[model samples]
Target: MGGRLGGVGTGLALGGGLSYLAPQYGMACDSFKELEVVLPNGTITTASATSNPDLFFGLRGGGGNAFGIVTRYTVQSHPIGKFYAGTLVYVLDHSQAVLDAARDFIAYNTNPKASIMATYEVLTTPDVLLNLDKFIVVFLVYDGTEPGTAFRNFTQIPHLLDTSKPNKTYTEVAEMPIPYTAELSRADNVFRIGAHRIEGAAGLQRPRELYDRYAAWAAANKGLYVYVALNLYPVARSMTDASRARGGNAMQMPDGPWLWVRYILSTPPGLLPGVYDKVQASFRAMVEATPSAPGLPLFLNEAAADQRPLSTFPTYSRLQQIKRKYDPDGFFVNRTGGWTFD
Candidate 1:
């Protein structure tokens, strides 16, 4: 009924979504009612709309860098039941067909009763017996109490491997071990054109050529390439609406249907400049292929030094104002790669 997934908890603690409704009903962070913070000078403060309101608004989505230090976060709780969830892995040889199927699914998928996540990746391990390349797809469907119905809908896909189960808890699904790791340094590249949200027939257009190139690159760069994952999550319209009511941020992409095309390039420790250049080239090609590419919006927490400046969106301005009010001297700063506001 009510439980917090530690993995999700760790994610939120490290600047992921914290609102109970977020993981439960796809709610946004600003929906939460309160937050508890410790000031730079060791002053304990509790904030909400009624008390310490400024700090409360600031911490909602403002990058949690300089607002003293959040030792504990008291969040609103929600009741959720059993749901359907699992991952679908595909071989590298079927990458083209899989990508095509995924595009079609997202385009014609009108069912509001299901939530699906599609990820494409190439896995390679140099331990002699573990090296392989393939396209892995993960689908998580939250079908209220009807897990069977959700599983049936997904089974329609002619997938190489389908692993759908029933009665799975939200925490179990949220904490499901995805392929990538949090600690490992990754060379990530993303290219997105048009609006954030695509509507109707337009959302169905498949980027076939893009998939081909990605697959080819992954194949050629075998062992050193490590892994690649392309994730598409429907940012529920309700989530967007809630965020707007709570004083919006720059994350307003399109409002229709959007996919997160993520390319995770992990390399061996010793393989330096050569591997880095190749990965960089792959990213460049991807961007060049896009018509109106807006570069990449680096995640503040995962961003490197050069990537830090890309985080300066309209939301950053609002976050800064809030930060100045509560953390004037910049105390609890943990912005990845030296991000600061002086």
Candidate 2:
């Protein structure tokens, strides 16, 4: 779920290595049957999906610290039981019927073990008569149970809080109160966090113009940032048919069903030197007025380090010819950091 799915070695890598269940169990390098790596010049090797197999299709969803360093992996583990997870809180006046019931449950839910991660937040109110504060947080999961009619229209909305939990165990639904904060420099430290994310893949439409482009970037950067969040998750097709029966990885989805959009920002690291350039020009004008779904793919560890992620992988020219056939002379493309292969 976090740890960018093994620190971007590809599983759920969207904080930097690009993955979110790898289109459903096919990302963390398609459950690497083996690894080992080393190269750059230190040369130790081993890959799988049939031995080197194009560096095992460029390490699953490519860009996990940009290849050659793995030193052991051999994944593929699945087997648990109880399901139906938790977290559900709503308020902003039922947020447009919870964003129209998550755009009709990811465009007509068919229940592929139903899932969701909806959110919509805005905060900042010094009480000069309360300036702003809104909410709609949901983090559901239904491997199956708890009135699971594929999340009965988000459990019939009208919620102010609904701590759902029944037949749990994905490590007890990853220990509830969900807001995956992996030790952000010791929690409870005011705000000042910047996760200005922008993910596309808008299939099955209904981007709802990304919540009217984050309510016009929170009414033009309210209070210079203390909270602002947006997210939605769904990408079924049985997780891309179980990542194409495991013979295909390197994330590429557009045939159908899709949705993944993120926009997060929080401030107060002493208001980052007085609202650093109107917060990067209001998050690049709300990512140039959000809209995408053309070719899908794009999640690469939640992009924005100058956003390239193997040019949004449609196998980016066979992952740049498998990174010049395993670092021909690039040495893991000049020693580290990912999304390379130009």
Candidate 3:
């Protein structure tokens, strides 16, 4: 939830934003009731189940700039009372155990109230799998004050830091792990996303393998990068049901219990143009080591511009229809940074 909050905007929410509460409710787009939008050719209109339904469908999870711009949103709001939540940090030595616990949590955690995100941070180069160059940061949240056995797997681990509190405000929970500051904003950050199905025990190995390969890439590209991260997000069955109950969105997410990995790489601030391309080529190769498991839609909230997320949605054809109707002149397509319609 580190980058998901601090302040969620129209783009983030419409682009399938997620949260600790997602397990209980659903993605941010599922909360929409109505939106007032400005179309490519300057028409002003409203979108919702009752009005402009096609536009509503495409705008929900099809949130790249290809769609019309939303000027106002009327969304569903939930109670944000105190909850049991906080951050947990572990050293590289405990990386395997921590990752194992995370995988098990994803596979077996059935509580809708319990949601968590695990991020393995590679802060330096020359990271040899089990060295001090890496560490893990996890954010845990339970809707109620008593998590019961929900967090035992993490608590059992001997960690370097634990900032969890039984009673935490919504704002406090959003800021756990780290606060979003100008320094972080200014970093040359690029994110690639991976989606994998949680098929029995394969789920356990997939995350671990992805993280290992990512670390290897970082080690091989020593000076080209400053920091790298692999953040794991669990999509629960309850979450999928919630989404469907809300009329479903453009992503057409299949039944849940799937995984979305956010791969972040921060290159040096000012690399020469040619060198930058090499770094990008290497990063692309590293991401290809584990492609998304065929059907899941890549997330736009954190995905790189070139990921072409729209094409992966099950409702791709429907979205295309919506695009042509809304922007017959291809105005948004020509001027904005959004998913390609073709």
- Model 1 clash count equals 4
Residue 119, candidate 1: Cα error in Å is 1.2
Off by over 4 Å in 3: 1-3, 125-130, 179-185
Residue by residue across 1-342, what tens digits does model 1's lDDT show? Answer: 111233434324323242324323333345556666777667898877888776766555444555666666665555567866677766555555655565555554445556666666666643244334455665656657564443443455556666567788776766655666313655343332222223454335434555666666666666665465544444455544555665543343234344444444555556678767876676546534533224323333333344343244445676578767776666656433244554
| TM-score of decoy 3 | 0.94
Say what the RMSD of model 2 is. 16.2
| TM-score for all models, in order of appearance | 0.73, 0.34, 0.94
Ranking by lDDT: 3, 2, 1
By summed lDDT, the worst window of 10 consecutive residues in model 2 runs over: 187-196
lDDT of 1 at 84: 64
Sorted on TM-score, best first, the list reads: 3, 1, 2
Which of 1 and 2 is ahead in TM-score?
1
Steric clashes per prediction: 4, 9, 0
